[model samples]
Target: MDVRLFKQVRAACNASTEKVADGLVGTIVEIGGDPLTVRKAKDRLSAVLQKARNGVPQLVGGPKKGEEMAVVISVRDLAELVVAARQQETLGEALDAIGFKPYRGAHILVGQSRKRERLKRSGDAPSAATAN
Candidate 1:
């Protein structure tokens, strides 16, 4: 993927993680603190797995307030995440090779313009506007 599109995807993924953690994405099942509730969830593990297979992630939260949570997702969903992560890593390596530095914000590429200018002066980069 191009740099711009990759940046957008990265931003969206970050937002999605935040939303999921906030219990805004899917069904949240509170466990951990309450022994009975935890036992019930364990007993109903098959049903929860089925729900996840149907594309509804089960957010397993801790019993205490403001604790970290875990998500139960289908293997398909997990594979997608793994693929996206690999693609992001590959693109990041390519960007590093081409002098694109990660900046403060999600969309910003530090020194990008300067790099382009330097490449142009060195006649090592093609001009996209004039290529066609």
Candidate 2:
């Protein structure tokens, strides 16, 4: 809600942090009414924010059907969160397609043939030579 917080969200967006995209720090403001669902309220609120065309935090989720639940999140923060969510989904799909079942620490696959040549000269494996 503060200017500083918005800046932080922008920075996270640049870094592509997923936590922000998942509405981790956003607050949900509930609106009570008759014959109106939470999802509808949320949608209406989102529309209003978008029309305003300002840098204020915006609504993420819609009002729930037959209920009242609206979520308000910083636009910048939401962007970062969305980026994180999408990246995870993409990575998962790629791994599944390749039948990859990782069972240990992350495997950092770096292409360093030139470096490997240098390491061979120094009588060391690529990893150890890079350490030097």
Q: Which regions in candidate 1 have their CA more than 4 angstroms from the true location?
A: 1-9, 12-37, 86-99, 102-132
Q: Please report, in order, the local distance difference test score of every candidate based on alpha carbons.
A: 0.53, 0.45
Query: What's each prediction's TM-score?
Result: 0.41, 0.25
Best by TM-score: 1
For model 1, how does the per-residue alpha-carbon lDDT over 15-71 read when each residue is reduced to its tens digit? 666754443322232321222234565888997778778755566544677665566
Write the residue-wise lDDT of candidate 2 on 18-117 in tens digits. 5554432342121111222445645586554553244344343334554423444456646754554344335666586467987888887998565443
Residue 39, candidate 2: alpha-carbon lDDT = 54
Query: What RMSD, rounded to one decimal, does every model reach?
Result: 13.1, 13.2
Best by lDDT: 1
